[model samples]
Target: MYYIENVDRKLFIYTIKDVYRLEASMQEIEKMTADTDLVRISRTCIINTDHLKEIKQVKNSRLEAVLDNGEMLIVSRKYLQDIKKVFRRDLS
Candidate 1:
């Protein structure tokens, strides 16, 4: 999966070319994928780091993840350190 997003209380899974509805909460999915490449980047988004191309800083202090498919997702302040540890790359 490329990413999972929760919008308006519903969850959708995005892949390279298609999207599917998933019948599970974010917490549950996170727990199940804890040992995998999937990592929660925001309250509404959990991304597959294996599909990540790069992450960069945008305006302000926000971090943005760019996927291999050329999609972008915001990395929130609350999960900055968590994401950094996963990639272990310099954020400067």
Candidate 2:
């Protein structure tokens, strides 16, 4: 299960898949529920566009999503397009 660290405590978000293996893992559902503009970068992580403080481009066209919580997550190259699409969809 994934655990999101909120101001008061950590919230548990579970899944049947191995994606929830890490206690600090960030799930797409959690992000999506918090913000519709969030995108699934991989099987393990999701990012909230509304909460994105910065986006750094790295090697191989990969990206790093810096959240307002000061957490950084690497976005896989494979999901880059999907991420953009999700944000666009949220605008419409």
Candidate 3:
């Protein structure tokens, strides 16, 4: 189970396997977005890592992720810590 943002309405919804269900509060949605598969790119956007196509180095210490659905999201410096965790280091 996971949750993602609705591309059109910007609503946060829960994803059960292959189904998507709408309706959740801000605090609840924030926790769900903190999962490894989902990353918050901005105050208003959260993307699913599983759907990510590519991570591109953008200007100003930012990363741009292109998703399977043709949506591009920018990972700002504010969320850099979370970003690094998603792409964990081997350290071996």
**RMSD (CA, Å), each prediction:** 3.6, 8.7, 4.6
lDDT of 2 by residue, 18-45 (tens): 3222344344355445445656665555
Please write out the lDDT profile of model 1 over residues 1-92, one tens digit for every residue.
89999999899999888999999999999989876778899999999988989888886677899999899999987887777666664333
Task: Note the residue pairs that clash in candidate 3.
Answer: none
Off by over 4 Å in 3: 1-3, 6-21, 33-36, 59-62, 89-92
| TM-score winner between candidates 1 and 2 | 1
Q: Which residue runs does candidate 1 get wrong by more than 4 Å?
A: 88-92
Query: Which is better, 1 or 2, measured by lDDT?
Result: 1
Q: What's the lDDT for candidate 3?
A: 0.60
Quote the lDDT for 72 in model 1: 93
* Superposed Cα deviation of residue 29, candidate 3 (Å): 1.4
What digit string (tens of lDDT, one per residue) describes model 3 on residues 2-85? 335545554654344465545765456668655456666555566666676877787656777677766666666577666556
Give me the overall lDDT of model 2.
0.57
TM-score of each: 0.86, 0.52, 0.57
lDDT values, one for every candidate: 0.87, 0.57, 0.60
How are the candidates ranked when ordered by lDDT, highest leading? 1, 3, 2
